[model samples]
Target: MPYDLPDDLAKLSLLDIAEAVAARRLPPVDQWHPGEVIDSKMRISADGTWYHEGSPIRRSAMIRAFSSLLMHDAADSRYYLVTPQCRQHIDVEDAPFLAVQMEHKDSALAFRLNTDEFVIAGPENPLRAEGDPDCPAIYLAVRHGCEARLNRSTWLELAHWALDRSDDLSVTSMGAHFSLQPK
Candidate 1:
């Protein structure tokens, strides 16, 4: 069977793409090994806003769809959107996606990402805090090595919840311990 590559990626709805990804129907982008490079005027800001040509990418669905294509190149330590035939670089100011909402799951804190994926914090996917001690930033591992920054408000909520745990500033989720401070 021929691999189904959409004719127009921008025209596809985010929900449809998310569903396909959830079903494991897409190819492993990391294995594509395409050498083509396309320069895009796209950048993802610190707050998870996508910008094109210095203007915000207003469509939520478009952002979600593009997020699905995001990949990190370990060889060069850069981020790209990789398709089977081509690869394009995108500037990520902080993280690709934002953890907009969170849920209390059984022994875990499930985060609902901006791209509509729910990730449960665990040993495989640990949370880390970086940056200044006064303003530490929270990040959640998404897939591969890509991470999503928890928005300021969401971080605050997590901090509040962490306070109840202990003074060392760690939380246990799904039988794994994650530190609020960088290790």
Candidate 2:
């Protein structure tokens, strides 16, 4: 559960960590798939920052600002924005906007809510999350339309975008609302 533990406490809670992790991740298979974890966390820091515990890992961010949906076309859709305190070193193939992902989960569309009106700014003089150098607010939108794809496309997009290319099969999920993305 404690993904970002301070090093000093590691020795004090070794056994507690093991039990805590399993208790957090396992069970409920008959009702939920092993991969289908529910909303686990939403934390706000003292410095106007926050962290959401995501499946692949935790996402740490500063509450910059967010975007609103401006386009009517579903294909273009909305974008959720965030500013990671550190430069996220990801696979070269996963760096571009066109290939970024969206996890298939409850309230998967939550990211797109702020759409085009989000950003995170500072704690010090000239305070800004990213300083003078700019980084594009990451876009969380649909690749295509609703009809062409099934109800699970949004999270499926995230799974596919985990790699350099998209998935071969179109259908997915246990019982989540899905969407479409451009081919």
Best by TM-score: 1
Residue 97 lDDT in model 1?
A: 84
Pick the lDDT winner: 1
Which lDDT tens digits does candidate 2 get at residues 1-183?
433322222132334333432343322212321332222243323222234452222232122121110111223332122122211111111111221112323212222111111111111101101112132112232221111011134334443543333353222233332222222
Candidate 2, position 111, lDDT? 20
Question: What TM-score against the true fold does each predicted structure earn?
Answer: 0.82, 0.17
lDDT on C-alpha atoms for all candidate structures:
0.76, 0.24
Question: In candidate 1, which residue ranges exceed 4 Å CA deviation?
Answer: 1-27
Where model 2 places Cα greater than 4 Å from the true spot, the runs are: 1-101, 104-183
